[model samples]
Target: MEKELETTVCEERIFESLYRKLSKSIHDFLYYKYGSNCNPNDTTQEAFLKLWKNCDTVSPAKAKSFLFTVANNMVLNHLKHEKVKLNYQKATTKTHTNVSPEFIMQEAEFLEKYNAVLANMKEEYRVAFLLSKAENKKHKEIAELLDVTVKVVEYRVHKAFTILKEQLEGFSIK
Candidate 1:
């Protein structure tokens, strides 16, 4: 007798089957891509949760790619956020006990303006800009990371810089 195929993840058996089929593969993918230090197991669980949550829109046939893309993007987002946090930590940890209060205030205000400008910019441009300036990554590296061409990265970085310059005309970090 043929078992009924599942059209949605609402079926317990089908969901279990998918878990059995995909869980190890997804775990392995995250492990190899981000290393186990990233907690591939946790990311895998999150990916599965997302799959369950979006099952209505994602057919079983498309679930594999969906899971992989979501997991990869989640890792990228985590990495980007960590990078920003680390940079901010490094910047703030530097001692400036000899600096005047006015200079410190100006620096803080400039940083606020810079963050606001980045937030208002297109995501692509902001990402390229941060990778270039914050991480000191080359355009080619940014292109590889973003899966875009070098020219595209260059354009985004340039646009980001132009926006920063225009918006922060009166402000200087130092």
Candidate 2:
């Protein structure tokens, strides 16, 4: 077992050397391909950790490609997990005000119409609308988060309103 332990330690050292050499370039490449929000630091760390854990399985020639593939998959998984979390948060965070039954009825009707209009919107438009209405995010903030122009956020908000107004027709909260 002592010889096996030594071999493992040697393998770990070699993996660390490779990781130190290739990490920056891989991170730069991923950042260029996927953009800045996806956190190159975390991705590179995860990729190398995977590589170190699986060192015996990875050949020297294919190691870099394996790292890139692992990083890319990590980024994709991160994006998907974020989407699921956002959707879950959006669903659960809605707060209903306690008011008169008549007022609550009106609010309910308006909510149904609002949801229907939102369903009709494109993902970008819907995202903007949710940020504006639910999160109360300003156009500048939404623009930064979505990586779009503030004017685009404004345009989407207006378009969302137009759609909602047309869909709701006589339904008024006030």
Each model's C-alpha lDDT? 0.85, 0.82
Scored by TM-score, the top model is 1
Give per-model TM-scores.
Answer: 0.51, 0.46
Cα-based lDDT at residue 113, candidate 2: 72
Worst 10 residues of 1 by lDDT: 1-10
- Per-residue C-alpha lDDT of model 2 across residues 23-49, encoded as one tens digit per residue: 999899889998889999889999988
- Residue 157, candidate 1: C-alpha displacement in angstroms: 57
Let me know the TM-score candidate 1 reaches against the reference structure: 0.51
How good is model 2 by TM-score? Answer: 0.46
